[model samples]
Target: MKLLLFVSLLAAAYAHGDCGGDCLKACRSCTCDLPNDGPSTDDGESPFQIGNKYSGDCKQLICKDHNASLIVDGKIYDRLVCFQGAWHFGYPEFLEEASSAMCLNPGNRTCPDDAEMRYEDDFKCMCKPDFEDMSDVFPDAPEDILPLCTNCGKKKLRITFLIDNSGSMASVIHEIKHFIGQLVKFLKVSETGNNIAVVSSAFSYDVLINWGEQSHDESAIHDAVDSIDADGQSYLATGLEAVKAALVQPTDENTQHKLVVFTDGSIKCGPEALKSLARAANNLEHLKVETFVVATNSRYTTRLHAIANGVEDNVFSISSEEDDEMENLKVAAKLQRRICA
Candidate 1:
C-alpha cells in the first residue's frame, strides 16, 4: 500500500513538470527535427530537440557532422539541409556523451552502462569502416514508438555495371580507374557479407565482362578493375544476361537490386545486343532487380533507354559530358548493399 501510494505521488509530480509540459511519459517526440538529419549535408552536429530527444526522422541516414551525404535509391543528394548559417545532422552525442560514456576516459575501468553511446551509423556500430552514412535507424518509422523499429541501416540493394571495354574505353580507362578507386573509398563495404557484385561485360570483338563471380571479395574487384583494357565488340546483350542472372539470387521483399549498363556505342552489339537487353528487361518484370543503362554516346541512346527500363518503374541516364565516376561508385555501393543479402 505504501509503494502504491508513492507511485501515485510520483506520477502526479511527473505530470506537473518533472518531464516538461506536453512531453510524453515515454520521453520522446513524434516529429523528427527536419534538417536535423537527412541524406546530405556537411556538419553532423546540431542542438535541436522536439520532446526529449532528437528532432529528426530516424529513417534519414545519420552522418558524422555536416560533411556527410546520403544515397537514396541510386541518386546522391549533397548539402540538402542548412542550419543557423551552417549544416548539421541529429546531434553530436559523441563529444558530449563520449566523455561520460568513458569513450573519452583514459582509464576509467568501471563506468555506468547507460553512459554507452550510439555512434549513429549502423555500419560503424558493427565496427565496419565508415562510408555512405550507413546507420541503423529506421527514420521512416513514425516517432513515439521509434525505439521499436530496427535500423539495420542497409536494406536489399542490387546494382549491375555494364561497361564498354572496347578500344574507346582504353582512351578513358584511366578515368574509369580513378573512378573505381574512389568508389571503393566513399562507398561502405558489407560487413555481414552483404556487398556489391560487379558483373561487367565489355565489347571489342565479341564481348567479355562477366567473370561469373557471383560474389567476389570487394578487395578483389578493385584489383580486377585493372584488367579493363580496351579491345572488344559491344555485345551488350551478353552483359545484360549476366546482370539478370545476378539479380535472381535474392529472395526477400526487402531486396533492392539494380542493373546499370555503361556503354559507348552500338557498333558492335547491333540487333543482338538489343534483343538481349529487351529479354533481360522481361526477365526482371517480377524480379527484384530493376535495370538501368549508362551509355557513353548518342549512338545507342534509343536502344539503351528502351532496353534498360522495360516495364519497371526506375531508370537513369548520365551524360559523358558530366563526370559520372562518383555516380557510378554510388551505384556500386547500392549494389553492394544488395549483395549483402
Candidate 2:
C-alpha cells in the first residue's frame, strides 16, 4: 500500500507538470527552440499542410520568417509561432555550420563552429502577427491582440447606432444623428462591403429594418431615428439584443455581420445578461462586432471594457462637463470617418 501511494503521487506530479492550460484549444505558441518548418495542423487527426511563411506583407519577426535562435537566461532556445493560419516559427533543420557562429549582437562576434554549446550568446527571437476571429456582436479584446490588415478581408460590417433615447439622451440625440450620417458616408464608398443601418428604442437603440431587406433606406432610417423621442428608463441590454437579432446573416458567399453599438447612458443589465450577450456574439463567424462607447462616466469604463473586450480604444470620454450637447454631437460626427466622395 505504501509503494502504491508513492507511485500515485509521482504520477500526479508528472501530470501536473504537463499542464498546458487552455491556449491549446485553437492556437499555441511554442517556447522550445527546436527547428522544424511545418504548418500547424488544427487539432484534428490529419496534419496541417506545410507552407512558406514569407508571402507579401506577411512577416516573421527578424529578417527571416522562421529559423531564428535566441539565448534566454544563459540557455539557447528556438521558438515557433502560429499566427493567421501560417506556421511562422519552428525548428532549424541543421546545426551550426560556419567556422565562426555569428552573434545576433551588433558586433557579430564569431565563435568556433563546434562551439554551438560553448558560450553564452544572445540572439533575437522571431515574431509574427496573431490572427483572431472576428465577432458578430461588440467585441472585447486587448489592444495588442487586434489583427493587422492593410485591406479589409472578407469581413462583413454592419454598424448599428444605438443611442440612449431615455430622458438622459435628449441632449445628445442630434449629435448621435450626425454621427450616424458620418459613419454611413465613410462606409458606403469603402467597397469593403461595409453596410450601414440604424435603429432606436426606449432607453437604448434598435435596428430600423422596418421595411425588411431594403431597410437601408437613408431617409427612412433617419426619419425613424427622429421619430423616437427621448423617454423611458435605460434598458441598455434589450436594445443591444434587439440589434444583435436584426443583423443580416446570409453567410453563404458574401456579407459579414459586425455590430457597433453607440451609447451615452448607463446600463441597467446585470452580469448574467452581459455574459449571455457575449456568448451570443462569440458564436458567429465572419463577424467582428465592436462598440464605440461615448460618455462622460469614468466609473462606467470598466463595464464598457467588459462589454467591448480589449477594444478600449473604442471608448471615448467627453471631458467637458460644461460643454453644450451640440459639442458632443460634433465629437460624434468626427468620430465617424468623413469622406467627401
lDDT of each: 0.42, 0.43
Q: How badly does each model clash, as a count of residue pairs? A: 38, 20
TM-score of each: 0.44, 0.43
Q: Which runs in model 2 stand beyond 4 Å of their true positions?
A: 1-156, 189-193, 203-206, 210-216, 248-253, 269-287, 318-341
lDDT of 2 by residue, 45-162 (tens): 2222121242321112231223333332233434223333333323322212111111122234332211133224433221122211222111332222221111122233555566
Identify the leading candidate in terms of lDDT: 2
Model 1 CA lDDT for position 239: 61
- The deviation in Å at residue 20 for candidate 1 is 29
- Writing each residue's lDDT as its tens digit, candidate 1 over 295-334 gives 4455655676666564322333333433554455444343
Minimal lDDT window, size 10, model 1: 94-103
lDDT of residue 151 for candidate 2: 16
Question: In model 1, how large is the Cα lDDT of residue 313?
Answer: 29
**Quick one: how many clashes does candidate 1 have?**
38
